[model samples]
Target: MGQVRDQRGDHIRDQSDDQSPDESTRKETSMQDSILQEGINEVIGTTHLNAAPMGIILRGGRHTLALFKRSHTAANIVGDGWFVANLIHDPVIYVESAFGDLPDDAFTTEIIDGTPMHRLAAAEAWVAFRAEVIGESSEAYSILLTPIKEEVLVRSIRPVNRGFNAIIEAAVHATRYIMNHDPELEWLIRHHLALARKCGGEREKEAAGMVERFIGEDSL
Candidate 1:
């Protein structure tokens, strides 16, 4: 009886070991599927009419040109050609506004052209632009805009490092602007900076540190 029980236990253990790889693979696949499905659902659920499209021109070095077209959707920008989308909550009028008619061969016209990833890139670009703008602003405006700016910054830092840099740069610019205009807002900016440093991941934390250093020592 003892021998039979031991053999049964060994057999059960062997079965479990054999199934482990398959189980793990299934779990991984399921997770990936969930993520993909969630992304699809988000795109579907989003309302596109409220947001505006921005022409994303990617220029490499001096001559390489990649033009990506995207539109603001649900506080982010969705590119027509990529998988990841950009999260630009407060888009500038200049970026969002159309100056001239779109080109005849513009990618925005077709739904099947760009991927969700391209949209994500556009969003990141917008964030970077915002960061640069904000980093040059006055202290008072930074204070007034802190809540919105910080919200955008947090979102920007989550997915891509480039996006994180954009948000940080923008925040730094805004801080500098505020310090130049209203020195009193520096204290508030510092407080917010501390909060941002504590909230994000490693990259975000690094960004927060950079922002704090830039703003803290900024001459303006």
Candidate 2:
């Protein structure tokens, strides 16, 4: 993986508003075309994507648990031209949003300027979902979305600190959703759980409990 270049810099990419009329139209057309996938190569999607922060932690709100809640926002230029889905979540949360079916087609693996971003296509979107069991019945909702223009990496990662237990509680929480849905990520998920186990014993029981509740033996 390539280094972040320099950690002291505040690298932000907010292209939604800066594009020229023609350039923006072209990009939009390209993204829409890519999504159709008549013959885009799978390997083209892997470019510069090997080194990206896999998951992120989110701070949720009260409506997060309540109905009409909105924590995460998915904004997009739809076939009709615009779409928005305001979604909510837990107080301290983990979210696996920017990914979708046909992974390669979902994001553009381009490093525009210095930031790596995927020009999410029509079928590709940003969404946030959460559910809770209400006795015998469980209610769930999803927030369909568009990619964000900017975000900060909480901490730059390196081989030295990217160990199993190195994941924060929020990382575990966010990852649970992805790990559960994608069987291919089983090994990566187990590695995080094993790290949680290592941080076990009474001292780390709270953390361990998090693992159990989310991805432990019974949960898995």
In terms of lDDT, which candidate is strongest? 2
lDDT of 1: 0.26
Instruction: Give me the displacement of residue 197 in model 1, in angstroms.
Output: 2.1
lDDT tens readout by residue for model 2, 1-220: 1111110111222222332334453344222211111221111111112111221112221111111111111111111122211221211111122121224553443343344444333212232222121111122222211222222213334233233233443343334344345554555555665664564444233443443344443333
| Model 1 TM-score (2 dp) | 0.27
Superposed Cα deviation of residue 67, candidate 2 (Å): 19
Where does candidate 2 clash, by residue pair? 71-87, 74-145, 94-174, 126-145
lDDT of each: 0.26, 0.27
What are the runs in model 1 whose C-alpha is more than 4 Å off?
A: 1-85, 88-181
Give the TM-score (vs. native) of candidate 2: 0.26
Instruction: Give the CA lDDT, 0 to 100, for residue 146 in model 1.
Output: 7
